[model samples]
Target: MIDVLPPWPLLGAFLLASLLLAVTPGPAVVYLLTRTLAQGRRAGLASVVGVALGNLGNAVGAAIGLAALFAVSSLAFTVVKYAGAAYLVYLGVQALRSAQAVPQQQAQTPPATMKTVFRDGFLVALLNPKTALFFAAFLPQFTSAAHSPLLQSATLGAVFVAVAATTDVFYVLMASLVAGRVRRMGRARLWGRYATAGAFIGLGAYTALSGSRGKA
Candidate 1:
């Protein structure tokens, strides 16, 4: 409850969300696993760090854009922000309550030095449309109006990058250990959906009860 990143509930929720996303063996995790299986563990680790930096950049951009809106129109931001968060939470809940297919695919990148691997991974992830969209779409739901918007944005970005890197490292380990079953673990996403939905609900409830809206 020290509230280093956001308020305790949001911080906890973000951490849970980050962990769920990271460990779910989604696109990013699958990408890392393929790299490890094809090239080597070192390359996979490099890619992990590189992708993390790229995601950080995306998160920062999204955070800045959203925070600037808050500065310009607190009233509009209030309406849009809550509405968007609610919609996303609804989507997450629906996903949690539904069953979905988890398809597996990986892009091939030739073996290379750690630096090249890192650079390629960085560029690839930085340019990924989903990264930008996801950060802008989801990160603001946890922001605290009590803090400076810029500070909150940066902290969330940093935390997201850190959590992603750590989780990617685990995928790299598993890939090295057993490449054949890496994609087979897609069932993990089912649990991740639950965790993500729970986090969303927790965040929405926290925002409602914390009185941040009244202060804002």
Candidate 2:
């Protein structure tokens, strides 16, 4: 196993890049933060694991040839991308409606069970064209021609997911910490709801409207 792995220099560089990218907030971060702010740490953490698993799944697909399939078909990419965008929009609308429907006192009602959070997070990450394209493009660069590309890609993807999961836990903690203060203020709570909805909608629109991702 060790012999098949990438050299230390390549692995080190990949890990560093993954760390930096993971810390910088993206759509996944927004989703986790919203869950934390609206619900609590447990919900947020469940989402983290779900998204991480989804990402790992994508990396595995890329290792196996999903990247090649997409590379060969632009229409396929467009279809998947729009489907993901639509899902995000649906979530945003759902969030807005939930905010209005749930009474302030009923905040005790936990709508996001761990399984629900995990499922949503998994679908969100899995359906995201950006995430799929990202792994397709990103993983191949660090692989060595001397080794089996599939093995190298799998190892790199696993490492990337692990590092990303760590960073996600950090964001969950930070979001949860501020959640208490936000909960105390009615106005803050309302606006936070808006912010989460807006973030999801904005990202969805962007995904729906964007042109084809340049290869890699």
What tens digits encode model 2's per-residue C-alpha lDDT throughout 124-181?
8877656666787888888878889888888788889999999999999988998888
* Residue pairs of candidate 1 with colliding backbone atoms: none
CA lDDT of each prediction against the hidden true structure: 0.62, 0.81
Residue-by-residue lDDT tens digits, candidate 1, 147-215: 676667677878888998998898898777764344245654344445545654554444334333223
Error in Å for residue 175 of model 2: 1.2
Work out the TM-score per prediction.
0.59, 0.91
How many residue pairs in model 2 have overlapping backbones? 0
Per lDDT, the best of the predicted structures is 2
Name the best candidate (by TM-score). Answer: 2
| Candidate 2 positional error at 141, Å | 2.2
